[model samples]
Target: MHMADALISPAVAGTMYVCSAAAAGYSIKKVRMDTDTKKIPVMGIMGAFVFAAQMINFTIPGTGSSGHLCGGMLLSALLGPCAGFLTMIGVLLIQCLLFADGGLLALGCNVWNMAFYGCFIGALLIWRPMMKHSMTKKRIIISSILGCVLTLQLGAFSVSLETLASGITELPFLAFVATMQPIHLAIGLVEGCITAAVLVFVYEARPELLYAGEQANTRQNVFSFKKTLAILAITAAAIGGILSLFASSHPDGLEWSIEQLTGATELSASGGIYRMADTIQQATSILPDYAFSNSDSVFGTTFSGIFGGIVVIVLCVLVCRLFKFFSRKKSS
Candidate 1:
């Protein structure tokens, strides 16, 4: 759930922005120190994949609202908490500045609630304890699903808390929570199942890829390169893009719940915070958030994807080079 600029006060937004930025900075620092070069490509491509996956919002059957996959926990499962956390920042930044999915002011809160919790609390907590075991297919599937579900649940709670703290809605604290949590529970289940499927696929197809990925990722304290990028592209194209065309078209759990509770598909934000968020979102999402739209000609669409891929490749290489430099300096 993206919080509109109108939903939060400037103070709250500013504070959250500072906190999320600090966290991102900390993650980057840790990655640099760790010296895992393999993770860079993995992080970049996975970020792109998340971007692609989040594009088509699928309506849960029987619900009028739609939901899309948020890949934070899934990434965390493969990339570890720190790399997962940092990559999430990259994904959210793309979504905010380019896709206009969430408001600029409200972006800090969205990242913190959705990504940070998933990477740090949800993925790390579950992955670390579970990965050491024999990690059978069933166990891996079940655990990944649970981690995904827990993260989303926590994220939904954070949103409710943040909204109330901002004093945006007239709904009481308990009322807001009561409305948010259960619906997210439904959403979380869907996310968990999808996460499990991805995890299982990776487990079966590229067991060593995961092993190699974790070993190569200096940032685990994680790193990866072209191999991971290839997987990311294939998965995004196959599962995220092609498969998404056939996803359900009913309202997602969140929207459905909002409609039931608020009597509207969306509750308009009247506060100053919401207004600022709306303005920023409109500014960011001027064109295709992920794919080429009618606004973009065929040539434009091809150009954008190529340009996007090149940008991702460059960023991955740069991050890796920076880390190597830091490692050399530290060792020297």
Candidate 2:
């Protein structure tokens, strides 16, 4: 869930921001300095794929609520933990700035809550241990669902805890967590299935990708055509544009959770110091809460998803290409 700038306090947000930045920096270093650079293209394309997949949040059957793929552990399992972490950072950046999926000030917290645990912990703790006994379809599916559920559940709880710790909301700490976690549990199941599906596809068609990752020192370059990556990015952008049209007029997962618990959904954003910044952004953002009033629907959602996908893919590619180039230069 994209925590709005309104929901978080500067202290809590700033703390998480620092933590997220540190973790992201560490992840990049782990991947860049330690791992082979040939895998960069895979990381970039997969980052875009995650962006696109997130855009297509499928409505949970019979619930009238929706959830999207988070793609963290899946990326890690496929790409290794370090690359997955950096890829997630790239994805979150696209979502926050270009898509306005999450606010600029709140980006760090969002990244930490959503990406850090999933990429690092999910991969290192859950997936790796489980994969030792079995890489079977059943095992991968079960592990993915479990890992994703735990990750989202943890992140959602962190959001509740962070906001409560900040003393930003009148909501009680346990109360906020209670409100957030269950819905995300449901969301996590969806993520689990989607991740398993993608992983299964890759595993079946190209087990070499995962097998190669075991030899982390010698990941082969798979940069030819790879049209799937480009197609996925385009598809994700299109889904974002299309979904902006039908985004439940009702509050989303987090907002809905708050509403169900409190009997009211709207929280006042007036008290925080970030208010001025929020105001300036509100003024500039044509669709602050993702709605366009004056302009025709065409202007809505704009191309941010597509634009974001492009930015993420390009940045990832550049980072990867640089890693590859330099690695080659050193070896030569």
Candidate 3:
């Protein structure tokens, strides 16, 4: 759930920005320390895939809310936590700066709430533990479901806590939490199933990719990394260019929660910080709401999805390359 500027205070936002930055720095260190550079390109492509997947929000039955894949666990399952976190940063940044999907002021909070728990907690605590002794289709399915569900629950709780800490009197803590948790539970279940399917496919294609770092030395290469990347790239293009057109029109879990509480999807925020953040977002958002400024055609939506996915891919690749360069320099 992407938090808007209205739901966060300047103090809370600033604090979260610092916390998320530190987390990113730590992840960068971890990634750089790992010698497997092959994951860099895979991370970039997975980031693009996640960017595209998030565009297609499926409706949650009986809830009047829609939810999309967060892709944190999926990335971690393939790339490990450090790279997964970095990849999510790319996805969130592109969505924030280019599409204005989430508020600029709230970007830090969104990154922490959505990415950190899934990347670290889901991957480390649930997925790895479940797959410790061995890997199987059953283990993958169970871990994916449980990991996704745990992450979403934690993410939802984090959002509620952040909002409450920000002193948003209109949204009482208990009520806001109650609404966010149940809705996201439904969302998590759907995401878990989708994640299991993707992981299963990848496992069949190249099992080594799932636990790359741990099994890199022992596992034989059954498929080329380039081939897997090609398949995923095609999948991303198809999802972003075609399936995004059919996304459910209902509000997402966050928006639905706000609407339930206030009868409106957006709240008014008039502080100087809020105004400044809003102005900057408006200025930078080239494809606001994932469509051209004056156009709402299918072409515009399709173009936005593909273009956004490309942007994420490029940004992630560049970031990974930069990290690699510095890592090499440090070793030298």
Candidate 4:
């Protein structure tokens, strides 16, 4: 769930921004220490895939809330937590600055809520433990489902807490929690199933990538990683360009929860800080809400999805390269 600028006060937002930036810095260090050059390309492609997948918000039955794939757990499952977190930063940055999908002031909060929990807590505590002994289909599915559900629950709770801390009295704490938790639970279930299917496909096609760090010199699955990457890239194109058009029109889990509690989809914010953030977002966002600024045509939607995906890919690669460059410089 992407938090809007109104959901948080300047103080709370600033604190979270520092915390997320610190986390991002630490992740960059960890990834740089990891000398796996192969992960760079995979991270870039998977980030693009995540950007595309998030465009198609699937409808949750009977809930009137739509949810898209967060892709943190998916990325962590393949790239490991450090690389996964860095990749998610790229995804969220593109969405914040270019697409205007999330607020600029709330960018740090969004990254913390969406990316941190999935990459660290879900991947390390749940998925890694579940898959440590065996990488079977059953284990993969179980881990994926459990990890996705846990991360979403944690993320939803964090959102409520942050909103309360921001002094937004429109949404009472207990009621807001009650509404947000259940809706995100439904959303998490769908995400888990989708994640499981993708992981299973990768496992069957290229199990080596999953265990690449463990078996450093394995050459048996060299071509499999590229094959899987190609498949994922094509899947991203299809989903973003076509399937995104069919996404549910209902509010997402966060907005739906706010509506249930406050009877309003958008909360009002008035302040110099709010205005500045809005102005900057307006100036930077070429496509707002994943559609063209001037038109809501299907072509605009399709183009936004495809173009966003490409932008994320380039950004992710650049991030990886930057880290790699510094890492090498330090070594030499």
Best by lDDT: 3
RMSD of each: 4.7, 3.9, 2.0, 2.2
Mark the regions of model 3 whose C-alpha exceeds 4 Å error after superposition.
212-222, 325-332
Predicted candidate 4 versus true structure: per-residue lDDT over 235-293, tens digit per residue: 98888899989988999999999999878888889999999999999999888888877
Candidate 3, residues 77-184, lDDT tens digits: the string is 998888898899889999999999888999999999889999989899988888787787888999999989999999999999999999854898899999999999
Q: Sort all candidates by TM-score, best to worst.
A: 3, 4, 2, 1
1-332 per-residue lDDT for model 1 (tens digits): 66556556677788889988888888777776665555666677776676656654666555566677777888887777777787777777766766565668888998998798888887667766676655556767777678877888888888777777877666567876787777777777777787778766666555544522442223221223344457667766554435555555555555555567667655665656566666666665544444455554444434444444445445655666765522533465
Candidate 2, residues 65-94: lDDT per residue as tens digits? 676677888788877777888888888776
C-alpha positional error of residue 92 in candidate 3 after TM-score superposition, expressed in Å: 0.2
User: Residue 38 deviation, candidate 3, in Å?
Assistant: 0.9
For all candidates in order, the CA lDDT equals: 0.66, 0.70, 0.88, 0.86
State which candidate, 1 or 4, has the greater TM-score.
Answer: 4
Error of 1 at 164 (Å): 0.4
Candidates' TM-scores?
A: 0.81, 0.83, 0.95, 0.95
Measure candidate 3: CA RMSD: 2.0
Error of 1 at 282 (Å): 4.1
**Residue pair clashes in candidate 3:** none
